[model samples]
Target: MNTENRGAAQPPEPARGAGPGPAGAAPLVDPLAAVRAERDPAVDVYLTGTVFLDIIFTGLDSAPVRGTESWARGMGSSPGGVANMATALARLGLRTSLAAAFGDDHYGEYCWDALAQGEGIDLTPSRTVPGWHSPVTVSMAYEGERTMVSHGHEPPPGTAPPTPRCPPRTRAAVAALTPGEPAAWIAQAARLGTRIFADTGWDDTGRWDLAALPDLRYCEAFLPNAEEAMRYTGTDCPRAAAHALAERVPMAVVTLGADGAYAVDGGTGEAAEVPAIEVAALDPTGAGDVFVAGFVTGTLAGWPLADRLAFAGLTAALSVQEFGGSLSAPGWTEIAAWWRHVQRYDDQNPAALRRYAFLDGLLPGAGARSWPLRRAVPTIGFGRGT
Candidate 1:
């Protein structure tokens, strides 16, 4: 593929004085500009799922004890769940649209504004139900892992999940496949020619049956972690599981947490693997979602299979170094900065750096944002008077 004009162009570098400041100041450089130039103006990616108000507690040396009260050194608040992926795609300039239920409470209002206005995601298909309370998740990050406690009420009787009867016509959509329940919109969107990329949560029922995931037939790609892939395919190796899964889907991507990711193109009988970048992770929340967003961006831009895997791993690597899930996702500026920063170290491997050289033509100039962009603050509300 000719990558020169694939539309991954980024914004011009900032001026000398324009160092990284606030998060919202920079305009997002669309990675899909080139592709969209020749295509219709339909939404780039559409998704539907539950949204949660996430309160993250970080800077912990170990997991909280069973009885003692633990005080975390740092904390942040953001919209999570499907909102993480939605924000990630929108920040990458994918023209993302989301359809999900929201409570009419303060948390719902904040999440709605954050995604719709802050991240430039389309929420026209999303609705807020009266008297319904938004779901909430409290995450505590320690030792590169996290423990979460979530709470929410089932919507009042007769209230359905916010899936539209007729989903929008988009280039692609992300689906979370449940074992027993099938999402009708997945098949609906596929019939309309929308490429589907799906990922599944842990099956609590312990029946990792591939037949249970009926929506796989419509998915263009299925992304599952190493454990999930192995369980579902009944294979010991994740790579073998990817091959087994490719028999049902056009492509299969299996993420190996620390080892990086592997992908197989069933259509071409080709495969690619990329090693994960080492970073001091503060929170792992939403890292998987960010990885999927990156892969979708690269795939939609017609990049090579290897380049797509590298980009996906790179984005997820960057996301873990931050505080919150949705807001922690890096933009073009951050990707550009990381590329430039790594080149300055003498110990860096040339071959490793070369893997990400595709970013050379797509990143911002010398004025790219500084490494470690500003993160979300702990509080969600502000004082009436400054």
Candidate 2:
């Protein structure tokens, strides 16, 4: 088995009674006591999947010619997959943790450092294998489109180690997986009594065994994009595909890029098409992952299916308006404000609204011509609008 250590250094403790203590008393306590006390029992949203370093190069008009190069307007490293989802959840004030594998290399260290600084993220379970290099994806974004080349190592053999000690308040977990690892992880997650949300990764190609579907039978929700749903169900129509999945799983959701998403309640035979949030596309890199994050967050917050889809769609729409994947994602407060202002506009005011509401009649409580209004908002250094 590949082995590598990529753990982040623990933060330094403050001096005794340096600030305020319980009742402002200079109470004596063990240094590790605070760390132990901070162990949140809240069911952490477990993001089990791949974490990659995204190297994005922008500023091309179309696909590059062989040996030809284009200047990159911007470039940076950001989290990918489960790491990105966990980051989004933490940003939304959910206590989250990541359970995944990274190579024992600088990239792995980078991932550890990046995630360690985020609020509500616990990264104790990330394993580093010695012979593997952390996955990396390099993409070029031009004219709002992107083409990418990725390299990911195979997972080491052996089951993941048991979870670290957690506070009793853990609430939910979302696990993203390729077909190779789905059955075992899904069964394990279901047995834990944790609300399990899952999405298909790139490995769910035609070769995947349909028998594995039974393993996911107990999942609270199963998410797959249009292409994945089509491949999995052997159908091009998303609604039909969703129905096929619902026949096996409890709930199935198929996200249609630019068209919105289709969800079905297996028990009630109820389905709804949540309209996509209209926004000018920049680079549609991590929009789907962001959508999953939004949906899971909404689920944990007890939101109805309609609102859940709305949150998911809105978050995805916003993600493409910027360059990086999770870097482009908006926080809960930002999304809430955007949704209230952009989606809830006055339908009667022709001059005030933007166009692109093709699903007005198709979705419930929707109006015609719902376009996003772009205003010059001040950007903080951290991608937040002030």
Candidate 3:
């Protein structure tokens, strides 16, 4: 439980052999272990990308046809994309920062206020672009999958967002790995000693650009979903694609929707895989982003590959079971609650729950009474101006 070594991303050590675990099992470490784990993190993670005010419509059985209107059983809006990831990270008690542009409009103000007040996410580097409308995404959740349509206008003259600077204590970053983002941005971040975790979009052209590979080498991890991974590697198998992509970076993660996820670590030549948690998925939106957030958190926490993958999958599962995209990512309180419930109910799957055994050490005695459950989605709060 001694975490004096800041630079070591070592695997989690064996159980301390003491009073009880974080979730009420046998003793693992001292009661202050969670506090110690949270201490002195310069900046846990920095995220950069388009932050959107997502308008999500869920509980629809199918998409509306061109000539007809549709009815949704549920609807709500929260942050999406980078905003979603940042909110997820912050909810995990990580000191999270976001560098993105916002418009000088109501949507923009709403997003800024929500992220700053609701999530306690850092926005010092985030700017307001006047005379521009904040990006808005319309997400339709149906049949366990979500379709998103986003709209954003070019910012007014000279309203471009500033270049991102990696803070001295910033340990990790999440950024888009696409042609729109310059390689130098990542290079500069790397020079500052920040680990970059990159993600890319699906290739519509079907020609996975080999030209982009060299530029992505600066990243520590490249995460792409199963279809994208297969398209880029020319392999139908996700595991094969992950291994192939690992050749380009230190870590390659291929996310398979229901099958779970697969990872290959280049430094250790270690391969690990975790199955998706079995649960009724209400909305699949933001599940991938939540998984990435979990992966980054686990990596920053120095968890091993297997534990990281399992934790990532668990977070994703928790996200899909709820309504909104970013709003659905569970925090430590939810994890602790689930753990206690499983123990109380004597869940059938002992081995499966053990994958989350990592949660025990996260909170020493699991005194979640002090920690409030943080929800990301909201319609109105006490702060609405009269």
Scored by TM-score, the top model is 1
- Candidate 2 lDDT by residue in tens digits, 96-194: 667677666777765666566533356666676766777888878887678989988666566333343331234566765456443465566566677
What is the TM-score of each predicted model, taking all chains together?
0.91, 0.74, 0.84
Clashing residue pairs in candidate 3 (N, C-alpha, C atoms within 3 angstroms): 19-27, 20-26, 20-27
Backbone clash count for every predicted candidate, in the order shown? 0, 13, 3
Full-model lDDT for every candidate: 0.82, 0.62, 0.71
- Give per-residue CA lDDT, model 1, range 1-386, as digits (tens): 11011121122222111112233455546566566654554678888888999999999889999889988999999899999998888767677778777787889888877776566677777777777889999999998899999999876765534466447778899999999898888888899888999999999999999899999999999999999999999999999999999888999999999999999998998999999999989899999999999999899888999999999999999989887889888777778778888998999999998999998867654345566666546356675796
What would the per-residue lDDT of candidate 3 be over residues 1-386, giving only the tens digit for each residue? Answer: 11111121121222221111122232332222333445444566777788888888888889877899899988777777688888777666566777777877778777777676556667766777766788898989998777889898766655655664554357777877774336556777787778889888866565687465555867899899998888888898999999998888899999998899999998889999899878777778788888998898788767889999998888788778776766777665566666666665564588877777877767555444322233434442346595
Q: Please tell me which model should have the higher TM-score, number 2 or number 3.
A: 3
Q: Give the runs in model 2 whose Cα sits over 4 Å from its true position.
A: 1-41, 102-105, 128-132, 152-169, 180-183, 202-209, 340-386
Q: Give Cα distance to truth, residue 95, candidate 3, Å.
A: 1.0
Error of 1 at 117 (Å): 1.2
Kindly provide the TM-score of model 2 when superposed on the true structure, using C-alpha atoms: 0.74
Candidate 1 Cα RMSD (Å) = 7.0
